[model samples]
Target chain A: MRFKNVFSIIGPPMVGPSSSHTAGAVRIGRVARQLLGTIPNKAAIKLYGSFAETYQGHGTDLALAAGLLDYDTDDARIRHSLEDAWSSGMEISFSLGVGHVPHPNTARVALWAGERYAEIVGASIGGGNIMIHEMNGFDVQCTGEFPTLVLLHGDFPGVLSGITHVLSEDGVNIGYMDVDRKARNGEAMTVIEADTKITAATQLKIQQLPHMIKSSIIDLTLRS
Target chain B: MKYRFLHELAAAGQQQAKTISQIMLEEEIAESGQTEEHIFGQMADYYQIMKDAVNKGLTTNTQSKSGLTGGDAQRVQAFSANHEPSSGEPASTAMAYALAVSEVNASMGRIIATPTAGSCGIIPGVFVSAQERFGWSDEHMVRGLFCAGAIGYVIANNSFISGAEGGCQAEVGSAIGMAAGAMVELRGGTVDQAVHAVGLALKNSLGLICDPVGGLVEIPCIVRNGFGAVTALAAADMALAGVRSIIPSDEVINVMLEVGSAMPSKHRETAQGGLAQTPTGRKIMENLKKRK
Candidate 1:
């Protein structure tokens, strides 16, 4: 089921030495960038398991850096992404994690830009596919395979209904949805993977809803 | 709209009176909710990347960042141009092209991962070289990619395509089977022949381990891609010549999953056993560590 389309098997033109290590790393970084809604001025990246062991040999570091710069997977500039980051005044650091990881190719990336910040934990499962498991300390699952909506809102009654109403009005069917909160009636996060791309107008409508703090659409298909 | 197994795909192709590639294209359109023109355009772009990588690797003598591998593809191309190879022009040229794309991959150049980057070279090698030999247009090769995609989809869902999970059999073996099956279709063979080619190619690669020296995608990995292209050509010819696999393609894929699961971790891209632990491999690893 993961390999839904023919292009998933035969395509995804990418700059690579290894899809799982390099291209998948690029996608993880790209997803983090999209979540943050802009290139961060500072980033902290943590590599775990196999990624830490063979990151240099596989160009995982460079690919991750390039992805944070909003470069596509096929961008040849990945080879010199570190230099690019330095010249662009992007403060980035990489560290190896020593404990258990959910997957062999796990990475925890935290980004900060002015007053905005985001944290993501994701894994490059195989064949350039990724599963993002955590965002801002919330346990959620997103694959970046579809147009996804991530919303931060107050944990209160009618918030979920308000969001789904916007999507339904736009004719965007929700293929999957995950809702998580730190505590009852506190801040909460909603992750929605939609069957069709949500229009910018629909996203704005959700963003203006009561108790909605932030809304961002991670549309990976557009880059492809 | 979806066919999970080779038999199902073949039956769908037969019932609908379409080629496997056509069936795959239709399925992709339905599942992705994209227009046929858009999907075909994306695949066409990937094919162009494949051709570009082959040309770049063959033309340049670029070394990887680790300096462990470089220029072997050009050397092979020179050898093929100067002397008659025992394997004939088709196989030899395909081997050279395969080496080229793999070398490009090692250098972190742009390329399409047919299934995975470790086995990125096989489909381009077979398709580009065959295009040169048969005088086919890029459009024809794009359709062949759809055929390859169909086979890879089935293998990926049924077995595995990552070296860490299933060793090189799942990576290079899947590529070879995909290329063999696609080549059969491109050569105007029946859907039955294409399925047989998948079985024949995969049967030859059942227990192949994924022991890359120093865990980099160089050394044995690149050379294996070269050999894989030749095997794909031979398997396609065999299937086209009325040879049928006694074991069905779907059964072969299941067996690959079973064998890959049974394989030891050391032989599954861990760089612990096989050639990765050789004296020279250890020396290379040590040197790389010192540099870091």
Candidate 2:
């Protein structure tokens, strides 16, 4: 493993009653927004276990809603996210999810803006760090710890090769990669954790590749 | 060897005959691919943020929406300022500052989650109070943070730092231990003394549950930060006086993990038991829900 940045352990300045509940929820919502490609017109936040039990007190609800608007973790506006959502006409709802969740601190944010939609499932794994375990019903893994590219494509040969070729040509180093499919030769999602920023041109090039259905870039290069 | 475990960090410091802060700074430089000046500069920003949080918390009287908390930080500050604290000015001041930060966190004010938000108070509490007494330089606080971060990293990767996963022992417990070690380093104690301070501070926090009344970070959490700061001071003082811990630092961490694992789910951050289940606690929860 590459060196774990000491800053990862030291701090992430944020508004909080709880890091796992508030800060982590903000990151998940931010990723959901990124995947959606626009400020969400509507969002359905389903929380499980501890999140469901104590989200209100921890400000987890407000944090998630604020995050969908790309609010930073320390934003004071987070406290009024629900009201803001209402006033902004961003329809939002929260529900107690009683189903499979990998961790106790789990949230499934379903979001949409116009024609674009994204379903993001993430776990707040303590200390405000999070792992986006699932996206759009596809079992993929990403932490948003680094710049990441999530590509939806047809599961076939050359899809991964073609994407990596573009990244390689652009001088982007792949830190980690995972490809998940529903079945042997079906739709797939590929997650690439990038060591360097995936330039706008690089992302466009990857999206333009044959068999690429959708591509989303989640930038964690800058620690917010 | 990598700085993944407490033993590795200790061994690296021993082999190079460097202080814990020195080893940590070198490791940070290697991991971040940045210059030491940059890291120090970033630390300065964090220091300023911490100071800002303390100051904001001390002055803010705005109550949280939940109506359960706010204003205790100011009360503590007032008490310390108006009278002579038998524990002395420095420790009392630290407690006040720590309470202020924790109060800030409880009220959803911006704060640096040092390791985690639930335990955010102890670091600033100790550092600011120590600064009030000794007036250490900005560089010294940065070094102390490096030392503190190193200790927290070991525990976080090896065991857990989430209250929901390992209870308050992992949350506040880790913060207090980290603060104690950092206090030692800032005061010019050796690496071994810093480790000893961590051990002393951690041992007593073991088996502590994470039960906040009404599932809020107020109630016990804010006041507990004051005690945690005091504990760090005591441990640092003992280590500086050449006190030795019978249990090694790594073993103490293991002990804390064991205790957290043995605890029931209700005892964690679920808020289903402990003080959270008391009659008054239940009333508070009901009132909060009614307001919502």
Candidate 3:
């Protein structure tokens, strides 16, 4: 069922020695950048399990750096992403984590850009596929396969309805959704994967909803 | 919208009076909710990428970043041009092209992951070389890719396609099966034959381990792709000649899953055992670590 599209099996033209390490790492970084709404001035990446074991040989480091720089998976510039990051004033660092993780190919990326900061934990699940499992300390789940909206809001009544109402009003069909919170009446996160593209205008409308603390759209389809 | 197993796919193709390629295309359209033109166009673009990767690797002295693999594709091509290859022109050319794309991958050049990057070269190797020999148009190659995709889809969902999950057999073995099935279709074989080719190719690749030297995808990974393409070609030829697998294709795939799961963790891309633990492979790792 995961291999729904023929292209998922046949293609995804990429620069790679390994799809999970290279292309999937790029996607994880790209998602982090998108969540931050821009290329971060500083990024701290932690590779877990197999990603930690064979990252250098597979160019996982370069691919992650390139992703933070907004490079596509197939971009030839991925080979020189480290230099590019240094030249562009984007500080990036990597560390290997020795601990139990849900998946072997896991990476936790923390990004900082002036006053804005975001942390995302994701896993490269193979064949260039990824799943973002944690964001901003909230346990959420989403695959970057569709145009997704990740939102943080106060855990209050009507907050979820308010957001879903805006999306439904805009005629966006939700394909998959996950909601997680730390505690009752505390901070909460909602991740929405939509079948149709969520326009910038719709995102703005959702952002303006009451109790909305932060909102970011990670539309991977735009990468071409 | 999709067939979950090879038998199901074969049945659907037969019941619909369609080729496996057509059945796969229709399933894709249904699952993705995309128009036929849009999907076909995207596939055409992927085919171009595959061809480009093969061309770039064959024409250039591409070296991997680790310096572990490079220029073998060109060397093979040169040797083929100078002497009569024992494998014949088609097989030799396929081997060269497979090496080319895999070398390109190791060098961080653009290429399609037919199922996964470690096995990326097999489809393009067989497809491009066969295209050159048969003068098949890009459109025909695209259809062949759909056939390959169908086989890959089943294997990926049922068994595995990543070395970490199931060792090299899951990666390279699945690629060989996919390429063989697609070749059968491209050669105008029946759906049954195509499915049989998947079994034939996979049966030979059973128990293959994934132990890359120095943890890079350069050592056995690249050369395995070259040999995989040859196996795929032979499997297709056997299937077309009315040879069938005594064990069904689905059973073969299930056996692959069992075998791969029973394989040791060290042999599954960990670079800890098998060839990766040999003296030469250990030396390569030591050298790479010292350079770092």
Residues B84-187, candidate 1: write the lDDT tens digits: 98888779999999999999999888889889999999999999999999999999999999999999999998998888778899999999999999999999
Task: Provide DockQ values for all models, in the order shown.
Answer: 0.68, 0.63, 0.72
Report the Cα lDDT for residue B126, model 3: 98
lDDT of 3 by residue, B55-107 (tens): 99988868988888899999999999999999998899999999999999998
lDDT values of the candidates? 0.90, 0.86, 0.90
DockQ class, candidate 1: medium
Candidate 3 residue A47 Cα shift, in angstroms, is 0.9
Ranking by lDDT: 3, 1, 2
Regions of model 1 farther than 4 Å from truth? A222-224
**Model 1 C-alpha lDDT per residue in residues A119-170, reported as the tens digit of each score:** 9999986778788999998999898888999999999999999998888888
Each prediction's RMSD to truth: 1.9, 2.0, 1.7
TM-score against truth, every candidate: 0.95, 0.95, 0.96
Comparing to the true complex, what docking class would candidate 2 get? medium
Give the winner by DockQ.
3
CA-based DockQ, model 3: 0.72
What local lDDT score does residue B264 receive in model 1, on the 0 to 100 scale? 90
Q: Give per-residue CA lDDT, model 2, range A44-114, as digits (tens).
A: 98999889989988989888988887887778888898888789889999999997789889999999888
